[model samples]
Target: MISGAHVILYSQDAEADRAFIRDVLAFPGVDAGGGWLIFKLPPAEVAVHPTDGPPQHEFFLMCDDLDTQLGEFRAQGVEVTRPVSEQRWGKLTAIRLPSGAELPLYEPLHPIAHSL
Candidate 1:
């Protein structure tokens, strides 16, 4: 059965990035011996977007309030890569990870299907 999904982020400084996810983002996880951490993600949804360029995938963390979340992230020393912008589906922005990768974040304006 297709029960769940696992997403991996490749980082230059794996330990630091792991710490950021565990401590900063406060995702609950278990240490799989030798300090390997595996986190439990929140409810997730996926979309397929048509593109003309090379095939790729992207991930975003969804929120109920973008401004409040951004403020909390800023106070935690996280870098905001882009200001929030309105879209038909959501209010979107990007934040920099500890590995210097930009992660998209959004608050959906459209109906959510995660619970359905």
Candidate 2:
């Protein structure tokens, strides 16, 4: 039986990365106790070619208030690709991290939104 999977990101500045998720995006995270940090995410789906594909994983997060989230990211001076666009199943936006990595933030329109 599978227990769980934790997505690990390599960051040049762990504190900045943590700030981007916590202060900027306001993600709910907890101190992993020994200086490690963990951000809580909504239920997600993993794509088959995660490691072979982009630097990011396949577990796409579906945000309920994408506009609000995007705005907060903007206010924090976080670089966003553009306004959320309508994808086949959800709305999409990309945010750049201090580690020079781009992560996708999205909101689902189909099945509208079930979880966070």
Candidate 3:
């Protein structure tokens, strides 16, 4: 019985990133001893795809409407590192974290499994 998944994003400025997750993203998380905030993500789904190269794991935050979400993020002074590009599976974009790392964001055109 799997309970949940915990994803970690390594950052150079962890404290600033944590603040961004807390204040900007508005994720509800408890400070687990000395301000190590672990965010509570929404329902998640995973998929496996064939690859020709080396295997690697990637994470993306999904949204219902990418344009609206990007607009909201811009309003908060968040940098949109990549413009949205329509793919066969989804519309994708990237945002810059406080530590100068890029995090992918997408709105899937394919069927989603998160509700199940």
Best by TM-score: 3
Instruction: Report every candidate's CA lDDT.
Output: 0.92, 0.73, 0.93
The TM-score-based order of candidates, best leading, equals 3, 1, 2
Candidate 3 per-residue lDDT over residues 1-116, each given as its tens digit: 98899999999999999999889889999888998999998889999978999998998999999999999999999999998999999999999999999989999999999997
Error of 2 at 80 (Å): 0.9
**CA error at residue 86 for candidate 3, angstroms:** 0.5
Report the Cα lDDT for candidate 3: 0.93
lDDT of 2 by residue, 1-116 (tens): 97556877777787888877787667798998985779976565554444655574343556788888778767878898666788887889888888877777788766742344
lDDT top scorer: 3
RMSD of candidate 1 to true structure, Å? 1.0
Q: Could you tell me which residue pairs clash in candidate 2? A: none
Clashing pairs in 1: none
Over 1-116, each residue of candidate 1 has an lDDT whose tens digit, in order, gives 99999998888888988998898889999998999999999899988999999989998999999999999999999999998899989999999888888889999999997878
Clash pairs, candidate 3, are: none
Deviation (Å) of 59 in candidate 2: 4.2
